[model samples]
Target: MNYQYNNFYEILEKNAKNLKNKPAYFLNNRKISWERVKKKVDTFARALEIIGVKKGDLVPVLVGNSIEFIVAILAIQKLSAVAVPVNTFLKEEEITFILNDTEAEILIASSKFKNNLKNIRNNTNIKKIIWEGEVENIDENNISFSEILSNFESHEVKELPKRNDLAVIIYTSGTTGKPKGAMLTYKNFFSNIYGINELIKLTNKDRFIAYLPMFHSFTLTVNILLPMFYGSPVVIIRSIMPFSKIIKETLLKRVTIFTGVPDVYSALSRAKLPFYFHWFNKIRFFVSGAAPLAGEVLERFSKKFKRAKLLEGYGLSECSPVVAVNRAELQKPSSVGPAIPGVEVKIVNDELIEVPKGVAGEIIVKGDNVMKGYYKREDATQQTIINGWLLTGDIGKIDEDGYIYILDRKKDLIISKGVNIYPREIEEICLKFPGIKECAVIGKKENNDEIPVAFIELEDNAEFNEIEFKKYLKKHLANYKIPKAFYVIDELPKNATGKVLKRKLRENIEEYMK
Candidate 1:
């Protein structure tokens, strides 16, 4: 498909005109057509204008995965304003840091997070607060979303943003430190949407499940933008509570494409589907991203579903969130498949020289999907994107067939006794233990030497014998690669995207060891 349009407004207008009454979103058992979405977005854009939002302004959106969240972002884009999506899971301090850092003038938050916003309202640059749902205490600056839509007239922006203009500033998950905003332009999103469409082959008849948070780049592109671009309807679940209900809804809605993290797939793998309901047969395929999908989890899910294949994908927030994905025709469970169209990926050494096919090195990407830069952080932008290629901190290798295999994050590598050790390898082996539910391997500094430490989370009513597990590891790993200590914990710290927080594990190693 040739992408004739540049900005998001053009796409929405075209889809609304072409697909008209076709459902664009499925929220709370209600189907919102493309025409309705366009109308709502237009009214919201006018409301934003009345509230003093203008071109180039940053509007921080702190909402969940609901229809309002989708409409708010589209409205911001229509007005040519930058949407800074804040993770709803963030604390007041973290949200405040992003708001003050971006100097966001407008904040659009859901009712559930009103208190969080109220806690830091006085410390932010926000002049207007648009509340999506009802709140107990409302202030002068707090405007109701329903009131805005009812009061404002449906209108278009006088001038739409150019393709190169900034559209969204997606803040990183900040597992290590303060999150940095990645500036994505209108062109970046369009190019990525086109590239992904070429690979996924989504159609208007397809229905996706939008359970992941929209703040993450992965969900924004795949779940939200992709469906809107194709004029496909998305089943937007406000919450993932009562997992069985979500499954029943998927089956009832006949959701075609499901995108989720490893944890979700793991849970689904263990779920006992009703004998009468063969709901999974309606799903065309399942996609795993955000975190590494275990082979064991994939095998179990594939066996259980029996209809859809769970394809593992790899990407980062900087690359419009999708760099490589497994094509159904040429699927490889171990590899993340080849780079998607319009993206160039190559493995390079420490000196940035291209490495051999089988050798592991830093993965660098050169593509239109790459972010403009880290907002207001020139040093970080320079360090990340050199020349035209973005230096992805992930360590990976490409096979002779062009498939990419991720080893581990470069920063997560353990250097013990001058020998480099990948924690992923250790963790992968540890997960094979029958009782182990989840595990993370990290390096502990001990007398100027890095000691490999393993943190294990056991399944319910499961027990772990350290000596037996260590003996099992000896068969598959070398003596030096084995973890020096094993600590069982109730749960491992994770970010919103479900990626294990290794940095947190390292910080709290003392408590875990005790």
Candidate 2:
């Protein structure tokens, strides 16, 4: 369990030397070897240096999950620069805010997002715009991906970054306000890589499917960092659309480890597979994170796949994102499992006192994997991390056996007549309905009182009876905890990371009032 590598670069170098001809990345029917990836990283690092990107400089990357995006980030790490990955689904205003807030010297983006960047060029401090694909009307400042690789010569970089040096700045999904960048150092990522490595026990022979958004911490660590650290091959698929393609790739490549959000698993569970769909049998297991995975979804997925085990985990952007996960051997479907190695987690009451076992309280963590602080937001950072513990803002309970059960987000709690109601509890019950595809529970204000409301999306050709649903809920929950009203919707508003934006649902409460 001793990790000999000091930094991410060292991990890559070690993997390249040991697994030279192995396929490091599989994308678009092309296999990129570890040796070639190392060479491309070196060449891109030289190109970045030629363009005046020095150590500690921030380089904001706006790209999808592709080989070029991987190369760009590895190149930035080679030069000890911080890679600020912007969510691809952000509005122009939000993207502009991140670029300005980070003061990024260079913006490396795919050509698909050029329109979003074109409008904000004059407003930010970006000196160079490097496009990963083809583009028209290119100028000196706006350069293409091929041009950089062809123009710059590959050279060895001697200046290595320290473990404490800042590596990347991940912006929170910002369900409430403007997104704040979580500053993660090399040590943070390295510690998490090791911690997760011990849990999953991945090897060079393992193949992973890289379908989640790379900007998010869960995808970055599990799909990218873990595979590279263990010299495993990753199959990169840019789009999750036409999910048949995902199934095809997973089967064809024999993907062993699949990491995804709860929504992805829910969809896969509902997808109708052919009788010959024996491809998933090769998959070792599936990991669910980003949002809470409903027990119903896990049960359905396990029944459908038959051979695949769906494990739930918990994390946030601030903790280099892998706080705890369930192990395959000692699986607990209800718990996200104990804290990973090298990390300490505890449940604290309102006054920050450690709560007794089996009592719900705020979950806080202290470890090397915790982020340094929020970028340029000292007040918010202070509020999030107090007394050297990163306050997770999540409500959960730890059992005497050390299994952690997440109850709900502290902010998502609803108070009705001095009684506390957790929205997750209602949503979990709503999911048990036969026709319910997706659902969200929020508190709506009515005449100075808060009332629980349920918004649901039904499956195709599925029937909905409000009375029957209420009758079903009465058996599982107290009358005060049941939703006062239920509104049928097509879909819930989600952020780039696939988390439901409850704030948006709260804003449109009038639409659901009827």
Candidate 3:
């Protein structure tokens, strides 16, 4: 990829000069200009430096979505320190684990998460804590965010960070086990920014939305960084609860591009929206990522909003969270489209041999967008990246036309008596049933025999009859492929990015069966 800027600071400085008065972002009624952001970033970096932050220092940030969150990360990069953004949804134990593991000395957190840090000072190595909101119970370790911003004058860094320098360490959502931190350089991020922009046409004129959790890689790359790379303004929503606030912002701010998960689209597909909202909105693209989009959700959403294209995308944290997405020029149903420009994606078998087109196998990617490796896990780094190809633990197949179709996660694959069963195939068929709104299939061990069992989430006030559902499935699938049992639920457990928590299902299967 032909990246224009060497690092994030380069882009920020350029935007400060080229688009000085332009609004960098919009939060509710407040508009922050690029010039103002640049001043705050430099001042914050100066204060951090005075506090002993140096090159290669890891600073943990537990802040939520706010102007402080953005400026703090820029300041960390400005001082050539690695920014470790922890998920705000994680518990105190999980949060402490990351801070202790990184050996961080400073933590930038929001006031809302103070309850989680009530006992944190005794547990971790964090010496200084910077809070974004009101400071009531101030101590020696606590510092106000506003005070830090005004304490120091705008200062330049002694040394600028290189493109290869580690910029961020993103902790994966620990569904299977302990969260692993993925080390990403500035180049790994810039590669995806340029690659995705090449496929989806975007300019400085377009306005985007940042409602998803910024700690997630999908939100950080596609929502936050991409807009900054283009000098486009973003509408920042604090939380997804009462998402009608997001709708109000979209219409009022004239947002042109939106990114969401499958659940958001499914809810929108069935919303009783007025015709005027559709006629007046300027939305050009509706992109889905983080998890696979159900065929039912995709179809209903496209039919509801014909003017906007609903493009399904696929990616993971290891690949800078953007491997491929469908473009406006061409789109195939249920496909994530082709790999982005300058990135090569292929399928391989168990022996690491290339698989033929239309054959399902492990998906591996090779590009500048691939991350450096898991932080402090050399064995894992070697196991994941072989021969320069990042072995994505995902199973998929590529068509002759280069469109990619993700089958399922390799770890989620179910084996029953020498037979392989992909849960997505069964879940897709289950979603087509009238009352079902969401579905998940997982392997259940019963008396040494493994069988596929399904969990179904139904629509509002909908009733389900197992006999009819079984008869319907028998027509579409063979006997061995059918789920042995079905459990109805009000809603499936989901992460911040709307990915179904299949691991949670596996853990609770016994209790539900009782």
Name the best candidate (by lDDT): 3
1-514: candidate 2 lDDT, tens digit per residue:
3557666888788878988988999997899999988888888999889888888899999999998888998899889999998899887888999999998868998889877876776888887889988877788788888887887789988888887889999999889888999999988988888888777777898999998888888888889988888899999999888788888898888889988898899888887876656644468879898988888888888888767678888889899998888877787766898889998999999899998999989999999889999999999999999989999999999988788999888988888998889898889888998999889998888788888999898999998999999999999999999999888988889986678899999988887666
Q: Best to worst by lDDT, what's the order? A: 3, 2, 1
TM-score for each candidate, following the candidate numbering: 0.97, 0.97, 0.98
Clashes of 3: 0
Report the lDDT of model 1 for residue 397: 91
- How does model 1 score by TM-score? 0.97
Whichever of 1 and 3 has more TM-score, that candidate is: 3
Greater-TM-score candidate between 2 and 3:
3
Give the per-residue Cα lDDT of candidate 2 at 455: 88
lDDT of each: 0.87, 0.87, 0.91
Clashing pairs in 1: none
RMSD of 3: 1.1
lDDT for each residue of candidate 1 in 323-389, tens digit (9 for 90 to 100):
8988888877668889989999999999999999999899999888899999999999999999889
